[model samples]
Target chain A: MEQEMVLKNENSLSSSLKQMLLKLTPSIKKDGIIKSLKNTGITLLSILMFIGLWQMGSKALYNKEADYRIEKALTERGEEAAAAERACIESGDSSCQPNTLPSPSQVWASLQSLIADHNLIGAKKNAFAKKMAATNEKMIAEGKDPIVYTGRASFVDIVLTSIKTVFAGFLLAMFIAVPIGIIIGLSPSLRSAFNWFIQIFKPVSPVVWYLLVFMIVKTLYIGDSSDNAFVISFISVGLCAMWATLVNTAMGVASVDKDYINVAKVLKLGTFQKVFKVILPSSLPLIFTGLRITLSVAWMVLIAIELLAQSQGLGLFVWEEFQNGANDSNSKIIVAMFVIGIIGFLLDRLMLAVQNMVSFNKNEMA
Target chain B: MAYLELNNIYKTYGEGENSTEVLSNINLTMEEGEFVAIVGFTGSGKTTLVNLINGLLQPTSGEVLFKGVPVTDTSHERGVIFQNYSLLPWLTVGQNIYMAVKEAFPKESKKVLMERVKEYVGMVNLSPAINKRPKELSGGMRQRVAVARALAMNPEMIIMDEPLGALDALTRGNLQDEILNIWSQDKRTALLITNDVDEGIYMADRIIPLKPGPNATLGPEFKINIERPRDKTAMNDNPEYKKTRNAIIEYLMDIGDERKTVSDVEYKLPELTPKSFVA
Candidate 1:
């Protein structure tokens, strides 16, 4: 009898467990947790493998010539004299030859130092602002103009400046391209008239554009200031990036479905209404794709433009680090490279999200 | 005077030497509340005729008139239901209908507009799928939404360009009934262009055949004098239905044979050039 009772209890427990499992199963299916977990595991494993290979390769490929030179110097000179040179090489000194190809750890340390430098600059700026506030108050009471703090930009500041310039150029490109694209797309005569200009300017190099913009901006500004540098660089970037957006927008507008156009006509929609309601909505996916490409091009051309224009941005930072020729500068440049790649990826993802939101074609989301 | 008139309409495509006349001497008239179906075989310029009536294309020689005024361009007074179910794929069914309704009654309040959209959506029995995008809906559902959108505008005349041609048999029958039910309520002027003679007879007050083209013209009209609220089962036993069907089939067969004979004679071999004797 007792055993029979125990079996009934066990059956009840099993039934409850099954009920709970059934309830949780739908949640798991809805969330796709298993699929996401698999993806995460794969990504982590690949990243780990990449880091492991990089570490092993860097150690195996140590500079033999530099080691030989260090050994020869140690033997030729006394221990006390060579100790300083050994310390410099052993400490991963930037000025030494053996430290040219930095390991991942060195890059990480450089990144940390850059962040630290940014914080230090922020604190300095805060102190300067406090001092300036006090000085300004005093000057105001005395009826005189207050002085401004003109300091060197930090790494974070340079990154912000680059982002700002690219967006400015991108916005400028959008404003110039979309309207002209629509007008050209709508009228065949206008398209033919502008086709020659589009074909010729599309292939022109960003460097040539920079030179042209520099000549124009130099005459306009007539001063050597960072602001002037930014204006010239972004203008060049805008001119170079605008072509893709313009061409894509025109193509998109021109290829709009004939049925939709007929629908607009049948509805007696005005020209403005037709454009905004039908043409723009239908062509948005292509326009966004063009914008994405244009933004990437703008980013790529920024480094060269900044190097030539001497603008205070991440591009300038990279150029400066390359010219610095210090042992740590290489690692810093590597950090900058990673930063640029990650930011580009993020910008593309942002554009994709916007495109998906606006586009009716869900199959093309990827 | 007829509500819609196509007077001696002649339509030609291309230009000069290469031009082919697709439609010729097309004279037809539709009364204010009449449902007329233009039946034809493939390539009969039925679509061209529909386009001309819709004012999407102007005739090369003749004129299209609506309410005694020459039809110069497309207007909201005549709404079209296209074969491809041209609902904006990106928009929900409700939004698609709402766009037309808004255009038609621009001065209506938002609340009133919403009610009108809901009312028309309910008319097609597609209230459940109103918020679904066209891509998400079936072909029949999309066509139903197209019908709702066109009807919601309360157009004075409705032009259907083989709107049911792509649907399955069941869906086609269902939509035909729904369309007829909607028409019974208001008796609005509607023109259906279809290749299906049975569909034409079932829905239209009169059935007209368009002859095979290049330079197709309308043949004799077959009037359907059956009573209202037609029963599909009862149509089989109806004598008038049998007679009309036989007449249209015979006419179409004659044209088909004639076209075959013409094509057989039209094919000819090009003259062979003499071989050149250049060494």
Candidate 2:
């Protein structure tokens, strides 16, 4: 009966569903539910232990004496003020203490408040748009341009801005690196000529690149503007992030199999056809590897560039919160940290998906 | 006039004291529509000779003439089936053939190209694997794709550098017949470079043995008088097949013995200077 069940499962129309059902049953088989349950139970238990430890540690470190002072200040006024002060202390207000680390509950509440703040901003944007629609229609009738809203960007908007900056930087790096790499890779003389430049520039930090870009942008723009900040930050990010891709692309092109080149030659392909058809396809796996590294570098460099340039992005938001030094600022910063990490992971997976689509060598994926 | 000629070819690598001569005094000629096989041991510069004929490599001191014109660079007139198959792994079997067909006949319509690709794929008996990449196919199937790709271009000459050297005996025999079938249709000028004696006698009208190299050269040509559509079993019983095979084997055995003595003498190291120790 068990053998029949196994065979049926193997030949099932929906094998994924069958597998899931099998995983839910408690059995000694390798793919059974017991193993999955144990794995999940261990993860949950560890997380619970960590939270419990954190809560206990926080209580021990917290200064109730600081709360007592604020309580005494309120009690000196009246019983009603004393009651309000106790409520405030219970509410975990940040103003009562300067150096207190937020408990997990406090951080959670901060997250909820941030969401509320984002929603409130969204409602304000909607109202502004509605109000502007009427004004814009009148302005159009009167042959005048509509006024654009200048509301403060929310946390979600800042995150989007950071994503946009990184993508822009990554694209710029690809455009600059790939063709140059291919050209250098094709000729030994060109590679030798550019070797010094690549070596010298590849190790330069984002800060140094930002300073160089800033000087150029300053001279070119001749005025302080938000657009200039955007240009400087992204350009700096691109400059700093492009080296890996450039080096990898050149290496990839240089190391393509000699047989493939001979095949191209025997086919009597033109230079363009040979490069596009044979060289590029064969070198694509390495090029995609370079691109993935370049993207990660671009993301890492973007934050520093944004912070240095005072641009409207997650980096700037984090830096501003750090400078503010409010009690909730630390929680918000932690939130941004998680967001950045998750986005970086997603970007890597995205590149991996694209690499799989283009590369023929499946073993290389591992 | 000879259709393809290599006159006094001498190919060497590196320069001056570092240079090693590979092919020396390699003079050869083939008539139009003739099938020739060059038999040689491994590392006897057979591939270099094939490369020279295909115009992929320039001779160090000789000219390769195709139809009385000097062979300068590779052209679609000579299609090569490399030993390693050399099908681009990213392209499907049909696509690999189509790439060559499109390059050879740029003026042909897309439909015509597709039809030609399908026809060639069918010719190789790989229609089921038409859309499969080279990596997905076995060695025999990849070699078949390589053959189809070369034949699809309809080149004036087909140069194969031990194309079936890597396959099992059964697959090799099957492909040999398939290649013979294709050659019979158009009778294009063909050259096969291989060390397999039976394969040479089976496939070519003329077989030339290549001597072992420090400077490899063609030894002698043996003409096969066997008729077409020759059955393998029947060839074993044929007097001409046995005589030709024995003569070629004898020649190869003589060269093998000669190579051992030549290498023993050639590879002596220079005497090292002895260092005097002070007391």
Candidate 3:
């Protein structure tokens, strides 16, 4: 009986120990889970802090009573103008007051309505026209004529148009920029001959390019068509954005290691194969960086061309908002600007992710 | 007749007002299936001579004949192992070796080619890390991979430019033995560029010192009549090894003294300052 009891005790103790070890293994992994949670909390706190700071700064800038009062007056004037137009007469000094600026709350409401309308009807040519017609009809029902209060295009409509043109221009710019840059960077004689041109054009300002493109397009195309204006604006934006891409490509190709070139030669690799497989892949980091910069410059120049030419795009939307002088239009413009910045940021981040994927040694670049 | 010869070569950089001669009246010959080591100090044009022989660079005057034909450009027959372990970082160990193997034998089927690669990779004892990229391997492993790569091509001649110079002593010793075993099996014409006198004595049938430059060229060659398959532990104890090492050391020391004498001339010059003129 004593031997049996002793054997049973030892067996139970061994089984319990195994169970304990199995439990502890998971507990060690659980520590990592807690550590990651703590990291996440810290990141969230930092983001909240940044947003709080931005809000506080914006409020402080508009804190003065004169500025605050002017914003209030503008809101009141905008409403009065709408009501007076309903009565078929100008609202007089109250409608077109120069000193007044729309309040933030009024602008926010305007932006909300614009977003709701866009989401409901979409930003297509036919849908936008239909939405406008419905809006004009609603004004008539309220006993107001939808006059040429803002002769410029609708804020949302102009933004949509600008986005389309800029993307087309950006694509065109990429095609020309990357190839030219590679050629210039790789060939010594080409680099020497074209380097001066690159330097002269890099800092020449998008507005100047926009103007030159506009004049050239206008003079060249005598076609009596509305489509011609859109084509002209796109060409202008593309030319302005092309420089950043071209220079970057050239630099990337030029910076590939001499050692790699020799390796290619030793392998007896053909010229085209060497370029694509060895040289191009090695210079991916610089090339991707150039692409990111070119994308942002293209977006920026696209808006500038639209604003200057009063052509379609986000630039035109911002310009239209300023002319409209209504609280809603001003707020809509602010929202459009936010959307532009956010999109550009996302595009750059995507390019960076792509760069990380294709690189040979990630740690060296990081 | 020598399999490859550098007949009284001259190489100079720049011209006219800024001319600088790098090598002058250089003459050397490499025999077939011979392991020759050239020991030199830094900037001794050892690498330049190797480059000229490999046809990566051409000499200004003399001819570099390989199998009695002048080497003008890069060729598969004259395989060069660079100092930098110039393996493509993006390519895996097996792939890098396979690239050269494929170029050396393009008509061979993939199966046979890969089998050859596996065999060579196994020889270097790197069959485990065959799929790993260059960056993933340690420095010693990378050098071994380079050795395996060169051997896989089965070139007529293999030129190594300080192949083990960057390695740790233990790794260097291991690779040196491995290289010797491979060289003995085929007796390929091998030229090693090294500054290690002891290493040269152990490996080569003969040692040649590339004298230091402004105008550097090969000095007198020393024959090591030591028996095949040298023992490193016993090398220091051997009288012939000691004598050969001391003779080469003495020659290097003399060259060093000559360089010092050339540099010290300005310091020992008669005073030519304004005070001297006044006196």
lDDT of each: 0.88, 0.90, 0.80
Q: How does model 2 score on DockQ?
A: 0.74
lDDT per residue for candidate 2 within B8-71, as digits (tens), equals 9999999999999999999899999999999999999989999999988999998999999999
Instruction: Please compute and give the TM-score of the first chain of candidate 3 against the native first chain.
Output: 0.68
Who wins the DockQ comparison?
2
**Considering only N, C-alpha and C atoms within 3 Å, which residue pairs clash in candidate 2?**
none
Per-residue lDDT tens digits for candidate 1, residues A193-301, read 9999999999998899999999898888776553698898899889999998999999999999989988888877788989988998899888888888898888888
Residues forming the 10-long window of minimal summed lDDT in candidate 2 chain B: B260-269
User: Which digits, one per residue and each the tens of the lDDT, describe model 3 over residues B98-144?
Assistant: 88788788899999999999999999999999999999999999999
Worst 10 residues of 1 chain B by lDDT: B259-268
Model 1, A26: alpha-carbon shift in Å? 11
Candidate 3 chain B minimal-lDDT segment of 10 residues:
B270-279
Which segments of model 2 are wrong by more than 4 Å? A1-93, A98-103, A140-145, A223-226, B265-279
Q: Best to worst by lDDT, what's the order?
A: 2, 1, 3
Candidate order (DockQ): 2, 1, 3
